[model samples]
Target chain A: MRAIAFKEWLKLRSWLGFMLAAHLVFAAWLYLSIRHQFRFEHAEMIYYQANHIGRIFYDDLRYIPLLTGALIGAAQFLPELLRGRLRLSLHLPMGLAPLVLAHLGIGLEALLVFLALDLAALAITIGSFFPAAFIGSALLTAAPWILAGIAAYFGVALTLLEPRRRYQAANLALSAGVVWLCHRSGQYQAYDLVLGGVAGLVLLLAPASLQAAHRFRNGEP
Target chain B: MTSRLLSWLCLAFLTVVLAAILLPAIYAMAFAPRVAPTHLFYSAVKQDFVYREHRGNHDFTYATASGEHFDRKAFEMSLPFIYYKNMELWGLLPIEIDGQSFDMQAIRDARQVFELKAREVADRHPSVPVHALLDSDPGKAGLSFPEDVFRMKPDRMEFLDVDENRVDPALTDRFTEALAAERFAFPARLVAGKQTILKPFDEGVFLVDAEGAVFHVKRVGDDPVIVRTPIPTDLGIRSIKVQENRQRIYLGLVLTVDNRLFLLQSDGYGLVELPSSGYDADRMDYKLLLNPVHPTAVFGDGGTVTAVALNEDLLPIAAYSRAVPGTTGMIHARISKLLFPVTLSLGTGNSGYLGWTVSGPAPLAFLGNLLAVGVVLLFGRRRRIAPQQMIPQLALAAIAGLYGVLAIALLPGPGPATGATGG
Candidate 1:
């Protein structure tokens, strides 16, 4: 588990750095905008400013986890399948379930590490201006994690089902469709429904894809 | 088999989706509170003349007597109590004339006297300041005097005739030109018995009687003056003229004489004695009533009076009064507080809801929660998934939902404390 976590950490380093950089720039922009626009005299005003900044950051940051999860899930799973890496791993001492579970474990670790670093950066930035409310800050810190999990679930299922050029194209088309539907619904709120539906679809599709892979590994035509 | 499994999975997803949507709706419907409207009344007083025409009674006599002086201290003592008891009833806008402060009450009293006396004077001297005669002098009579003139200012004087009408031209042009560039003085005669005096610092209009005592004249309207003579209590209006629709009520005995008129209108939420034009020969000793009739038929302590031409059933067909644009379609019904819910819907089709929407706050919070949950779930599935990975993502989604809940809690709820302010 520890080795798997470390490997996942190494894979996620670049993405985490990007997330940090983006959020830092966003936080700086928020600080400047708030300082310029509002007179921060009272504690209530400072709290309000912090809350506004948090909301803006959260709105933008929400998309990052979803995209990252999908990309990482596809990259890690599809290449292994196309190259028959899973078969080689299965031949080792590990059981099929353990090998699959290991991949899920690594993916989850990367997501959690990225979320923690990003949240810490946000807290430090906002804390300079407002005395942080522990509960509120903690709550805000947790939002990115939820987004990443939904993204990862969909990515895994998509990668497992079709590890080919056609599958890649289909995944891209489906993602675009999801984004289009969310935008046209006139309520970005439908993102949750889409994500949940996609997660369920992936879970349903995963077992079938793995069974086909298992048959191929056993040399059964 | 795969298709059946997929269908069951889809069904499970649909159930979750429905619960997510319905839960927020139920919470909002149960917890949200309502807001109400604020109510208030505003009033102002002015000096004007009231008069009645009697065709064959020409026996006019002039009597000299002292004018009743207003006691400011007495007025001040009664005022605080009036404000405490009837805070919503009276609106007071006080003015100063020669170091004497007069409230709305004084203005109402002054208006009653002026209207009654002006009518008598108009009847007696039908030819005085005759517009026909003045029209003959084109240069001298370019502008018609407003029906009611109340407050006098240095550069401007406010005149309130019957219809809240006003006449204000540059003093430098109108009066200075008429007075041959001389600083105009009060009690100055444009013609004898028909004088237009400039109050001190051009403060107000002070129309004087024959013996040189100042009688305040409050203008009512543009039409020929209409006054009601003392009919025996039993003798009601037999058949009021259709054309002469606007009317005022005057009461009280004459000052220093047998017949006086008091304007029966609210001033600062209470009754006031306004000045009026005196017509009897004993003008100095005479009292006058200058009750200014509101244009609207429905009257209350502080509500504005707008005149409407009603059918025999008292249903309004045509109304003549000042109203803001877009308010012309309003059906003015005297609805009880308890009946507001019923009557509120009756006129709403014609008049758009001039108030806020009740469900505006709920949808915003729900949307926030959805976005938060979607983003967290997406991010949580990224690399190698593990039990630990779910913890952070789940925590974040919960946090976002809490923030949305807090926003909804902060919004103001509904109730009966909202009212529109008058300009």
Candidate 2:
């Protein structure tokens, strides 16, 4: 399993590096834009815009994390699954579940590293000029975006892993439904309670992937 | 055995989930809820329903009991003073209403609205949250943002001047001493403050202390006005909402445990309880309109919208209430009534959270599940489908509804003679 995980890490390392650099660029852009606006205008005006007008400064970075997750999943899983390498790989020395989980785990860890760095960059740039209260709310607003990143990775994983075209389409549909739940919220921190359930949905995708592997091993047409 | 168990568990869960999703979608598409029209507005004072037909928004027409209709222009013209701005903009001002020429400025000055919504109310704590008292009497320049936000400790009060990044000992001590003079109990139960600087003028804030004693705290120039209101002992005040109104008649509003409404009058913090009930602070949304003539207070507990009109005396003039049906009524209700004996729902029509519960059924909501399972069983008749596989297939249809049906059709066993894990 360690060997397989290490193999997975080797495959994902390049994508991880790319995502990290791309996200840092985005963070720099967000910070620079805020600074340019605040340089000309009053700090009090920006504060008033948020407090009175209900404007969120970080609204532009909404889908960036989502794309990061989906792309990471695609880069890691799509090539392996589409080439039917996972079918050949499943016959290795260990139990099927651990091998699949370790494979998925490597991709998830890379995505987390990228997200943490993105948040730190946000705190440095936006945090420098804005008050503690406003910056805190902006971070909470970024939570859903990060959650979507995780969901997108798992959804794309399950969709690609299924053997039959019929099952693959159904799995993708179900995966999309779960991701849709994560994005339904309009406000920050509104999804705090239901996040546990969403985690369960993502984990359930693992078992579904194993089932697909079983069918693929049995040579199902 | 372990590997086989994993396979069955996976297949069962996936089957149940897909069945749950598809069954409901097909049933819902065929039989969805209907959009209800607005109902009667019964006027208790006049003993008749004021049948208002809203033609979109401002484009509405009103009719009397005898069916004398007033169009949008005629309606504004009739009220002359109520819709004074509309009349003036349309060159209908200066026309005397009821032989008395109404001053538009006077009417504007007298108009005041303080919306006290229960859902919008902040719950009181044993020890109050953060407090900020703005300089209510900022001289010359009028209302401006506070230099600092003040917080109360158990025995002492402190202020963090955000601009200076240090303690504002002078103003903090002045206000803290005033609270002591008024005998305000420390370790405050609920501390609320106005943070916004956009107002005609600041009206300061209302707070409750450790002993449930309510106090009016404000900054009058550099001096502090911290006085305890004469609220009756043992009165459960849930929250205090401060409103800065031009009328200056009332300092703020208080919503209590009884879902009762009260005005903290400007003079000596006198409390006036308005006639209202059934406003559960947790569930209902309330809106208050303050017009010089006919003010109205409307509150609803989602299922019903209750409106009470008030005269100038702040007493109830007329009341109107109506029942609003729930989502699964009419079409969804009719279909569910005719089809299945039970329907399974995840969250709700409004929310997308994953909460599992069973609702009133569309009896044959599982028809899709049954059909798919039947076809699978038919093909496998010669292969002899095991009770383990066959029973779950049946249960998915019975329990999951349409989504179960779709799952069975989509997720099949590996093949005949191939045990497919648990089997």
For all candidates listed, what's the TM-score of chain B alone? 0.17, 0.72
Model 2 bad stretches (over 4 Å): A27-38, A122-139, B1-111, B123-134, B140-142, B146-198, B220-224, B291-295, B309-313, B316-320, B325-329, B336-388, B409-423
Q: Model 1: per-residue lDDT, tens digit, B1-423?
A: 342233223322322232333343344355422211111111111121111111122321111112122333322323222232232234434544335555556544433222222122221211212111011112332323332322333332222221222233442234323322222334322121222221111111222222223222222222111122222223211111001011233222222122222222212211232222222322222222122221112111111222232232324344322221221122221111111111111011111111111222233444555565554455434433343534423443343353322211221111111110000
Candidate 2 residue lDDT tens string, A1-221: 67877878788788777887898789889888877777776555555555544566666677787788889889988878768777778788777777777777888888888778777777776667654555566666677677777878877877777666776776677667666656665554445445666567656665656666556566664
**Residue-wise C-alpha lDDT for candidate 2, range B104-212, written one tens digit per residue:** 7756766676766543476411112334577877776666656566666777667656444356889778878888888888877666555577677886777788888
Model 1 error, position A61 (Å): 2.3
For candidate 2, give the lDDT of residue B219: 85
In candidate 1, position B347 carries an lDDT of 12
List of chain A TM-scores, every candidate = 0.54, 0.89
